[model samples]
Target: MGIKLLSIKNKFVAKCLLLTSTLALSGCDDWVVMSPFGDIAKQEAFLINASTVLMLVIVVPVLLMTVWFAWKYRASNKDATYEPGWHHSATLETVIWTTPLIIILVLSGLTYVATHRLDPYLPISRISEDKPLPDNVDTLVIEVVALDWKWLFIYPEYNIATVNEIAAPIDRPIQFKITSGSVMNSFYIPALAGQIYAMSGMETKMHAVINEKGVFDGFSANYSGHGFSQMHFKFHGVNDEGFDSWVSKVRSLDNQTLNHQGYLKLEEKTTGHPVTYFSTVGDNLYHDILNRCVDANTVCMDKQMHLDKHRAKNAVKHKE
Candidate 1:
C-alpha cells in the first residue's frame, strides 16, 4: 500500500513538472490580458476579480447548503426531524431574501464606481496608484484609422505615420482618436485598455497609459473582412528617450506620403501586410475620412446636414 501511494505521488510530481515546463517554453501570452501593464487594465482586472468573489460568496454557500440539506434529511437518517405539517421558517425566508439583497446592493455600488472610473473616454488621473499626473503634462495624441484589415497610426504633432504598429511613452497619458476608413471595427489592446468601436463617418475616443515597458499585442476585435484574422499590430511601451528614438527611426524610413489618393489605394483588401511608414499625411485627410468626403467632388456630411436642417426649417415656416 505504501509503495502504491509513493508511485502515485511520483506521477503527480512528474505531471506538475511537465505542465510547468510547457508554460515556461510558450511564454505568458494567454494570461496577458489578466496580467495588465496599464493602470486602466489593472483596475478592470481588479473589478472582475472582486465581482467574481462577491458572487461566489453567495454561490458557494448555496451549493454547500444544498448538499448538506440532502445529506441531513436522507431517508436512512432515522434521527432527522420529520414534521409533515411544517410549512415554513421565517429565519430561512429572511436569510434567502436578505443575503442576496445585501450582495446585490454591494455589487451595484461596486459596478457604479468601476464603470465611471474605468470609462475609456475619461482621461486617466494618474499613472498608477502612487503616481499622480501633473497639470502641465502634455498628452500624446495618436489618430487611429482602421483600414481594410490594417491599422494606420498618424502622429499629427510629429507629422509622421506608421501602418500596423503603434507606440507610446511609459507613464505618459495617451489618447487615441479612432475612426474607420470603410467598415466598422474595434480597436483593442488587451494589456493597455478596453476595446472601442471605430466606424466610417464617426470618431471614437480611448484614453490609456502604459506603466511598463514591453511589446504587447493590438488587434481589431470586430470582424471586418477576409483579412480580419490577420489584422493585428504591435504596441511598444517605451521610456521617453526610447519613444523619441523610435519616432526618429520611423521618420527616417518613410518613403511615401499618406494623402487622399494614397489612402484610397490603402482601402484595398489585403492580408498579412507588412508594416509601412509614411513621411507626411494630408492636413484634412482624417477630417475627410470622418465626414465621408475624401473625394474632391463629394460634399462633406456636416455641410449636407446643415442644408437639410435649413430646408426643414423653411418647410415648417411655410406650413405655419
Candidate 2:
C-alpha cells in the first residue's frame, strides 16, 4: 500500500512540472513561433533576461519577507516581540536603498553601451559563430511604403515590386528604407528584428538579418485607421535558390504596368490583397512618392524651397 501511494505522489509531481514548462514556453501570442535568433537578436534577448533577473533579485526577497513578518506577528503568537520605540535602522535603510540603486546603475550602463553598439541602422559586425561578414555578400535593399491598409515592397536591385509579400535570402543583411503614404505606422517583425516607425513624407532606415529559413509574421504596430487590423505582411526568409525562383515567378507576369492612375487606384483600404508584380514602373516614381508629388503639377520639396527663397528675396527688395 505504501509503495503504491508513493508512486502516485511521484506521478502527480511529474505531471505538474511538465504542464508548467509547456505553458512557460508557449509565449503570449498565437502568431509568434519559436525560431532561432540571429546574432543581434540574441543580444536583445540576453538584455531582456538580465533585466528580468535583476528585478527579481529585489522583488522576490521583499515578497517573502512580507509574508514572514505577517505570520510572525500574528495575534495568536503571544511570544512575538512588540517594541513601540523600534522605528528606524540606518543599516537596514542603507542596504534596502543602495542595493536597488546599484542594480539600476549597472543596468543603465549596460543598456547605454548596448543601445549605441546595436543600433539598427549600424552595419552588422558578426554574421554567424564568430564569423566576420564577408565583403562579397551584398546587402539587399528593400523600399517599403505603408499605405492606408496595405504594404508595398519595392526591390530596386531586381527592378521588381510586390504587394503584401516580402522575401529575402537567408544569412544576408537587409536594409529597409521605410516611409508612409498616408499616416504614421510602425513596422514590426517579432521573430526576426525590432520595430521601427514609418512616417509620412519621411524615410526611416532599419538593418536586420535572418539566419534561419522560415515564414515570419510582420504587422503594423501603430493604429492608423479603421482598416488598421488588416495591415499586415508575410516575411519570408528563403535560400538562394528559393529567392531566385520567386524573382523569376514574379517577373513572368504579363500585367506589370503600374502607371500613375493604376497606383492611385491601389492606394485604397485593401485586405488580403493578392501578391502583385510590376514589370515596368515609371522613372523616379519612388522619389515622387517621397516628395508627396505623385500627382501631376503638385509642388515638391525642391519647388517649395525655391519658393521660400524667392519670397525672402522679394521682401528684401521691397525693404530696400
lDDT per residue for candidate 2 within 53-128, as digits (tens), equals 9989899999999999999999999999999999999999999999999999989988998899779888777676
- Top TM-score hit: 1
Worst 10 residues of 2 by lDDT: 28-37
> Model 1 compared with the native: what TM-score?
0.87
TM-score per model over all chains: 0.87, 0.85
Give all candidates' CA lDDT scores: 0.91, 0.83
Residue 89's C-alpha lDDT in candidate 2?
Answer: 97
CA shift of 285, model 1, Å: 1.0
RMSD from true fold, candidate 2:
5.3
Worst 10 residues of 1 by lDDT: 25-34
